[model samples]
Target chain A: MADTQRPLSPHLQVYRWQVQMVSSILHRATGIALAVGSLLVVCGLLHLAAGEESFNYFKSLIGSPVGLVLLVGWSWALFYHLCNGIRHLVQDVGLGYGIPQFVRSSWLSVAGSIVLTVLVWAYVLTPGGAA
Target chain B: MSAKDVVVKDRRNPLKVARGLGSSQSGVGHWWTQRLTAVALVLLGVWFVVTVLCLLHADYATARATVAKPWNALLLIAFVLTMFWHAVLGLQVVIEDYVHVRWKEVVLLVAIKFLAVLGALASVLAVLRIALTP
Candidate 1:
């Protein structure tokens, strides 16, 4: 609560949204989601460690419909963060500062995340391997 | 020693040298650690996703076997440990930056650490039990 009141200056609404902004916003958004998702990871570990019966319960819980949905969401979030994080690292080295470069890189991050996710799922869905 | 120290100081403004001492976070240690863990995750995460994806259509035994593989077990443990560690580091910065309520912040920080540790330990041990027992 502000003790002194003043007319709030016109803010974020005034600016045009850009890809960098979108990715930047999404990065934080995804980070928060992943943080929450970490709890499931914890549960999985605890179940696995406790022994086969307990771990079986954990497995069943995850194999449920709701668990599948949460997993899909978190998988996307993790991939998005991974791709965007690499992009930010590149930018840290003083590359991709140009407006065009910045915008394109944002798309690259998004595309890369989707592509990676697809590749992973594709490999997973294959007949042998882990299946 | 005095002459050497005086000569170094004389070369630049004392402020310039002194500035490094403050919490400016100049080194790449944190940044590098974050990126390094990220790079590891890209590989581990993809592997993990693939592992889970395969398990998606599999029965309980199949899924359990997949996790019980030597490579899968080791990587799974590594992935969980590194991920939680990275998360704590990330959250610590976020909490410190915000969370002006000092006592609340302290409790939250401690809680986060405890949870991460508990999570990592459980995951690793789980992987071990599965992999080692059969």
Candidate 2:
């Protein structure tokens, strides 16, 4: 963005991608996704307050294939953001700053989020449905 | 006319120099609040998910009854407030990062705050209605 047209420092395409990078990017991506997902929460509350018919309509919408897919994606996003968010909070407190520890924690966040998503879906898809 | 006067005239204002720090003093406050809300949401969000899952197959009356429980109603309201607060903070940062046009960015920033307030209020009102009615 200078008059000389020199290449920018630390250009993204020049660097090799790493877990730390992916984790950082996912934090932003998932944050945006969760923000959008909040609308669904509002809708659910509104529908429930409206009456039985409205509530059932909301339920059926969520039970549909497209809705199920969105739910799965949003849930994974929520878990990813949650796991990475904790890692970020830990880092904010001055822990896990070393290169080795940071990289390890990055991978931990990713794996932990996946495990959580699987566990949640397992519960939701099971017989009793989280009784 | 004097050398001292020339030097003073050429120097930038101290307040202007400080302003160049670009609101760094408030950065820590923002960071801390985001983390604090994250911690709160971690607990509240997990509880909410579990509660909703429990209501997944419940009939209308059962769902209403579950929300009508005092503790459930309180936590739902708390969750709505915290979630929207955290969300607006997060979205503000996202917009600031990607939207460089000053006027548009300011408009969007203000608009999101208003919309979030409305969303949070509406959600809380809906919860109260379900809890208090019949």
Best candidate, TM-score: 2
Candidate 2 Cα misplacement greater than 4 A, ranges: A1-11, A128-130, B1-11, B14-17
lDDT of every predicted structure (CA atoms): 0.77, 0.89
lDDT by residue (B43-105, candidate 2, tens digit) is 999999889888877999999899989999999999989998999889988887767567889
True contacts kept of 1: 0.46
Which pairs clash in the backbone of model 1? none
- DockQ per candidate: 0.33, 0.50
Q: Write the per-residue lDDT of candidate 1 for residues A1-131, one digit (tens) a residue.
A: 12336433333577698788889878877877887798787677566656668878887887688986777678778889988988887887889999999999999989988887777666655666544
Measured by DockQ, the strongest candidate is 2
RMSD of each: 7.8, 3.5
DockQ of candidate model 1 = 0.33
Candidate 2, residues A57-111, lDDT tens digits: the string is 9999999999999999999999899899999988888999999999999999999
Candidate 1's TM-score: 0.75
Q: Write down the TM-score of model 1's second chain.
A: 0.77
